[model samples]
Target: MSIATSPLPPTEAKEAAPFRPKAVTDFASAGLNPALIESLVLKYLLGVGVASGRKVAHELGLPFGPFPEFLRGLKAQQIVTYTDAAAANDYHFSLTDAGRARARGYLEECAYVGTAPVPFADYVASVEAQSIATENPKEADLRRAFSDLLISEDMFRMLGPAINSGKGLFLYGYPGNGKTSIAERITRCFGTTVWIPRTILVEGQILKLFDPANHEPIENVRSSLLREDDQDDRWVEIKRPTIVAGGELTMEALEIYYDRDNKICEAPLQMKSNCGTFLIDDFGRQRMAPIELLNRWIVPLEKRYDFLRLPNGKQIRVPFDQLILFSTNLEPKDLVDEAFLRRIPYKINASDPTEAMFRRMIEIFAPKLGFREIDQASVDHLIEHHYRRINRPFRCCQPRDLLLQVKNYCIYNDLPLEMKPEYFDFAAENYFTVL
Candidate 1:
């Protein structure tokens, strides 16, 4: 397949350039879907076999016949070349220089927009500054780190005041109301390198300490700064201290472990989460009792600091700088008693959106995913028929999900990219439950 043409060079320098279409547009121009191009890039990077036309079809979930056409398009763009003549008739593909560049450029763009890669040591220091500043003017550092993209007007007001008050934040709402999305987005506000402790084998023993930046083993790390002549030049130092833990976190994961060889204890999750936001998503659904989790966190949550004792009877007071966000769909009263709830300084309810909001959200997501137009009336009809008729709460993610289903259906049936009422019927049947 031929590769797609590149977009024009960037016109102006930007602090953060908007996403410029290069490979994606190139493939689209050659009659391949942009999403298919992305899948190809991912499959190639993952080293999955892309040798047979049938295998490519199976892997990409596309029709078998179209695989040759897709490969031809890629070849035309010089993105891939077949090594053996026999492979030319098959899907055996390899990246050309231009193809590799396109893949790397696309990833760089994603990382630029999504993650802020900061040196591990600097990230730790910033988290400390943000946490300490929470009581005063310095709190801006921490406050800015927790900003969201599309927060409601009420939430913006509540969040700022609540954070300054040094109170915990509580976010609750119906499922698919963007509660978890909003919480996850907060991490983007900070520079990279969330501090998380990891288990490392030092001297043939497992000891958990603040993992060094860049996830390198302790033994491999250079102990001191070296001059050019003294340097081995074999290893490059990089710092990555950002830590995000969910799902598998236990009380033991939040404590110090004794490292007999190093004579130091491993730092727990709370310690690693310092200076970063610690989001407790699906708040009431953990295996641990809600009261137990709340009680364990009460002292540190209130004081913004915690103590950990070493095996040899030494203790260290670590700064608790993590901005804790509790996200749940369960009712506030059901999740915690009034007394415990009060300890959480800020409460933002991520309620279901109004009809107007839902419509706007659809309009926003439609064009991005190749939905040329959304039938507002059709969407409203479904909302009224499927959701309102059944007394289900309006969900923000519904539009995104519906668009995905429509896109998938179009691909499955080889239909033109258009939003039809049938798409909603399909979505409703597959996704929604009758109330």
Candidate 2:
């Protein structure tokens, strides 16, 4: 199906870029009907004993289109009986004995009662509609994304094209540089949020897609200004998700997670990050071997879609529509062979901050910490005495880390927060304890 996705040029970052599913006002537009969703509402009512029809609609994140009628139909069949009309959409309903038995049967099969899930076909259409690779990020967008962080113009130039690729990129550099920080801010470049379903149904199995901990839901204030006649609450608008998986990422996490006991299916990490960025932080430090992890991703990265096996042993294809980032302190060469690396087109070096850039970072950060403006003297003192004498190279995090130490020292000593050579010495001494 031809779904309407916004063609967001890099300059259009300020504009809305969500996959606006049009004309989704009624049960038909939602891609499911009363017959499909009513059972879930019945199961929900059985679980809670009694709830309003509007409350049921709210809980399901579906419209009352044909649903109030569906409930009335249940009442006509003597399966549901309204106890009272407390308020608008506040009619309390309860299931009859037969209804309870049927609800129990549904529960025995699977107990998922929240949000009448969007059909898997709709989800796939939405993903294709808002593919991250389609965004053409301009230099302005990059600047806006990293405006808070002290990024050099050269670094911005390198990052603009790499991030625009939206395929995959290796952010490799020393540990203390801004690889993680850069990865974190990559989502800001798109400056757009997309719609994602909380749950998806496929071949009688329900896979939960939206993760509250990971997906930050954008509050809908502009829906009141839309042309679709109304908003489809089933589709949640979330920030272009930036899912960061660190050293703990396992091979199991890359595939669909089926609960043998609960019989529920949770979407893989890639599924959660559709139309956004997926960062594999501290890349080679994962519990699994680097080769094994790289090999697992070889298909998803290339095909831009993933194949997942359902509980019924049926395989399904899901859109791999995210910019997968691998951030590592390890050198890219030592980690993966050429064949694997070939799939990931862009590899940008998060090189250590230059001395000038390092100083500027301090100047930028010191004031933000409520300290007086840092002077050239403090910068010179750090480079000449602490760095040059100790043979220490500058890292991007040092300025912020050193300031943090100085702030703590000032707090303990009851002194004003300001940058001084002595404070630098104290901070550097403690900060480089391992070195």
lDDT of 2 by residue, 1-435 (tens): 899998778666535555675545567777776666767877898989988877787788766555678888898988898988956554778999988987887777787778777889988999887878778888888888888898877788888888887788999999889999999999988758888888888887889999999999988774532222456677788899999999999988888898876667999998898889999999989889999988777998888988888889999988988888999998899999998889888888888888888888888888888887766788798899988887888899888898999999999999988878898889988988897
* Residue 263 error, candidate 2, Å: 2.5
Overall local distance difference test of candidate 1: 0.57
The top-ranked prediction according to lDDT is 2
TM-score of 2: 0.91
- Tens digits of per-residue lDDT, candidate 1, 1-435, equal 999987665442223432211111123232344553454443453354235544444343233444567677778988777754543356456667777677666544332111111222333443454452333222354446544234555665665565555455888988888877776655444444322323222222223444554143324343432111222221222232334455555677677765443343455766655555667778877777788888887887777767766554555565777567888888778978877777785788887787777778788888989988778778877788877887877788888887888888899999998877777888778776542
lDDT of residue 137 for candidate 2: 82
How many clashes in candidate 1?
28
Residue 18, candidate 1: alpha-carbon lDDT? 21
